[model samples]
Each structure stands twice: as C-alpha cells, then as structure tokens.
Target: YEVNQNSGNENENGNGNRNDEATIHKSGNRRTLHTTRGCTNKEFLNCQPLNLKGTEGAVGLAHWFEKMEFVIHFSNCVVECQVMYATYTLLGDELTWWNSHVRTVGHEIAYEMTWKSLMKMMTEASCSRSKIKKLEIELWNLTVKARPKMLQKAMELANSLMDQKVRAYVARQADNKRRMDNNPKDNYVHPGRDNILTVTLSRKEQRKLLRVEPWT
Candidate 1:
C-alpha cells in the first residue's frame, strides 16, 4: 500500500519538522528508527505490527485505530511515514480496497492525502450511522439496567466497612479494659462493698501491704 501527502496540508507542514526527527521502518516484527536515510543507529525491539483486516467491524476498527495511534506515537513516525506504515499493515480485503482507492484517486492525489482523511474514509467504510446508533442505544440500556445494582453493591460495601470499624473500636476498648484490670495500680478496694477508702490506699495500709512496720 502506498500513502501520499494527498490527505492534507497538515501532513505536509508537519513533514517539514517531523521528517527531521526520525522515520520508522518495519523489519519483520520489529521497527527501527533512522535519523538519516540508510542509517540504523537506533532500534525498537518491542514494536508490534498494526495488522487490520476490513472485516473487523466498528469495535474492531476503533481498537485498530487506538493501536495504530499508539504505534505511531511510540515509533515517532513522521507524517508521510505514518500514513505509509499504517496502510502497509492493512491486510486482505482492506489492502485491496485501499489499493483500488489509491488507483481511483490517482497516486498524486492519494500521496498528498493526510492520515486523518484516510481514517475518516476507513471509519465510513467500516461503520454505518444506523449501526453506530444501535450500538449506542444498547450501551445506554445496559448501563441503565446495571446502575441501580451497582449503587446497591457500593452501599452494601460501605456499610460492611463501617461495621468492621465499629467492631474494631469495641475490640480495642475491651483490650484496654483488660490491660487496666491486670495493672496493680488499678487494684483498689471497691468503695461500695469495702470500708471507706478513697481511690488511693492510706499510708498505713500501703505499709501493711508491703510488710514494712511503721516507725514511732
């Protein structure tokens, strides 16, 4: 497949600066970036191929467009090279259609065509307006049906979290009470049951408990 600047003025103007940077050329599954013609100073080992056949429908076309855009950005593909490389990835019927399109439009006109124009043409060819509208309606219906359940699930999760926090607080308070009970400082006589004793023991009681006799 051949891509020409026939698409738009934007590509031509962009080519002035972009071409100065790098041009990505595919070699097998990998792509290499060349700053100058016939130079292979930098290589990208992880570059994936952008193979898109015409039969993929609207969803597939959107996926392919996303992938192509990612590849273009990742490879830093120049404007002309972007159109050329992306078109080259088209397979089977898509390739045939593009070739026929190029021939009908003439190479000079097709060569000047921008990437945006090609995308518009491809989208129109792959998806009909009625089909797109049907898809939108289906998506809207699905979302509406699922929204209430989703909200209910969210509320249940929030209430569960609050219950866990409450339990944790109660457990912490219980643990603190246990610790206080085990401490000797908290072993005071109960004022309601025992003889009148303030929160603290008298000095005599303290000495008696320690088994130390008071001096005269």
Candidate 2:
C-alpha cells in the first residue's frame, strides 16, 4: 500500500510539471504577441495620413497642401501615394483650383481658364528647387519604411505634377513677356489674371478620379 501511494504521488507530480510547462509556454507567447503589437502601433503612428478639410476655400486647401507637404515628403504608404495622384486629378478636372473669390465681380471673366494659378503657387512655394531637394532626402528615408512598394510611385506622381507646373509657368511667363513687348507704352494690364489655387467639391472628385485609375 505504501508503494502504491508512492506511485500515485509520482504520477501526480509529473502532471503538475506538465501543467506548469504549458503555463510558461502560454506566457511566452503572450509576451511575443505584446511585443508585436507595440511594433505595429509604432508603424501606424509613423505612416498615418492627415485628414484634409479645405477643399473649396483657399485657406482650407492651403492648409491641406501644407499637411501634404510633410506627409508626402515622409510617407511611404501605397495609399498615400494615391493621395497625390488624386490631387493631380482634382486640379485637372476643375480647371479652376481657386475659390470664386479669386474671380471677384471686378475681374474680367475669360472664355477658358485652367489650374495654373493655384498649381503655380503650390509648385513655386513648396516645390521650389530648394524644397524639392529637401523633399528628396525625406523621400529616401520614407522609402525604407513599411509599404515600400509605393515609394517610387509617390515620387513619380510628385515629379509629374512638378513638370506640369513648370511647363505651365514658362508658358505663362512667355505670354506675359509677349504682351508687354507688344504694348511697351500702354502700361496695360491683362483683363483676367492667372494662377489661383483652391479645391472645392470636397474629396468626391478626388475619389472618383482615383477610381478611374488614370495613372494605371
């Protein structure tokens, strides 16, 4: 009977040891899971996008553009790349990036207009050669972040817009020069001005343009 009691005690001890091993294993897994969650949270903070509120008003759109300058310069998310492409389409569709206030009752209305005003301003202000150089450095750092696949695409979009703005600016400058040369003595000013920047209609147009996937 003493031997039988000893054998039972040994088996009970073995079972208790197994349970303890399992508990430790579970705790280790929990720690690993917690560590993973912490890393993911950091990624979220690093890659999170800013919400742009100014679509119609120049002040609002200006703020939105300011947010984008930081975001695009440092963001590597595929979705964020699409955000810039989305902006291009937004400016293209309206052909007028500024608010109606830009076309005050005093200014002469023209037959056809385009997005040069606002596009030129943004490209000149934030996308200047100096700023572009700084952005290039930031973009390189961003490419090493998560979702690296879209980094090149984001750069492409920005470059394309900059190219477009440059072409438009040159054309406008030439036109201005031609006008001045034609009437050196008139001291004439053009009836309607160019270069306004504003976006309206919320993000609906941007979403629709991106949906078309014109860049693809």
Candidate 3:
C-alpha cells in the first residue's frame, strides 16, 4: 500500500507490501512531501508539530516496538559475541552502586546523582520521542561527572551485582533449553540468525532504552 499521505489519498499495489513515504514542508503558502536522500531519523523526530490537518501522520512517531527479543539460550560463542558485553556489564555496575549506597552502613557510598528514577523510567516506558532519548544521554553524562569518590566500594558492589545477574539469566536460559530438549513434541522457538531476544543484567535492566542494544 502506498499512501500519498499528504492528500489523505491511499494507493495500493497488487502485491501485499507497504510502499510508504513521509515528507515535511514549511514556509510559503505552499506545501509538499518529498522523499529525499539526506533525511535522517533524528531529523524526523526533531521536526516541529504541524497544525496542518493531514500532516500529523507524516511527522508523528510510530509508537511501536520490534517484538523480537535478542537473547539466545545456547552455550555457543556466537551468542556471546553479538552482545555488548563490557558496556552492558558496566551499566549493571552502576545499578549495583545505587543498591549498595542504600544498604551499606559506615562504608556507605553517597553518590549524589539526581537520576535515581532513571532505571525505573526506562523499565516502565518506551517511546519514539527524540526528546526523551536526548534527556537520557544528558542524565548519563551528568552521572559520569557526579560519580561518587569511593571507587573501591563502588567497584565492589558493581562487579558483584553484574556477575550475579548474568549468571542467573544464563541459568534460566539453560533450564528452558533442557525443558525444550525433553519435550520434543512441544513447539519451541530455537535461537536463529533472524531471531532477536532481549537480554540484560536481571529483568530490571532489560529495556528499550536508547534504541536497541547491540545484541538485540
């Protein structure tokens, strides 16, 4: 289906496939929707809201997610290679820092980051708005600069929590595989080249944060 989108006219081709095109026009008393080669998603999201009647669909964010998950349950190195192991592990480390600061006493870590709601914000929502994505990056940069002084305590908590989360996730995957192996007749979706399963340090960390993660 191909829709002019601008004129609210719908056009369709014989075969069932989408032939969509989006455009933006501003200034002058004229309007046009053009498919240009230099357009980018960031630019698309940054566009201002249009008061035009049919322009909303053209400039609006497609509030949808790729239902596919990226985590694979195999022991093979292929699955491991696809994931951003160091980066994601580092994120877990940060979460660990927060947990320890709250629980530990005399050896308490008092990192004063204003983004305590960060993890929760990510877990609860996923939107196509560019502003939110930009805000997240801004918050992260702030956190880096506002990091706590007690490096030893921070590292200790981070590493411990990260390891536990990874191990537990792997164990769950292995158990699921064993169940599928035993019940051959049961329908099971095996990890494949096209399959995408999301993975993270515990369920808390898995989110559609800033775009899809490397592995996903």
Total residue pair clashes for candidate 3: 7
lDDT: the better of candidates 2 and 3: 2
Ranking by lDDT: 1, 2, 3
Estimate candidate 1's RMSD in Å: 20.3
For each candidate in turn, give its C-alpha RMSD to the true structure in angstroms: 20.3, 35.8, 38.9
lDDT of 2 by residue, 1-216 (tens): 123222244223534432111111134324211111112223434655444323344454566556555544454323323333324323421335323423653233321222334445544543343465678878987866745667778989999999999999999999998988899776654544422222444345776877744345
In model 3, which regions exceed 4 Å deviation?
1-149, 188-216
Query: What's model 3's lDDT at 106?
Result: 25
Model 2 clash number: 6
Tens-digit lDDT track of model 1 for 1-216 = 333232343233434544345455776666555453221113211467558877677787889889878876776655666666778778987898889988898877876778788899888877664486679999999999999999999999999999999999999999999998899687775666555444236766778789888788
**Residue 139 of model 1, lDDT score:** 100
Q: Which candidate number has the best lDDT? A: 1
Worst 10 residues of 1 by lDDT: 36-45
Q: Report every candidate's CA lDDT.
A: 0.71, 0.45, 0.40
Per-residue lDDT over 1-216 for candidate 3, one digit per residue giving the tens place of the 0 to 100 score: 232342453332335433354455654655555542332323322332111121122122121111101121121112222122211222333345334544663222222222223323322332332456679889998888767655767999999999999999999999999998899877555666224333334333544454445564
Give me the runs in candidate 2 sitting further than 4 Å from their true place: 1-146, 187-216
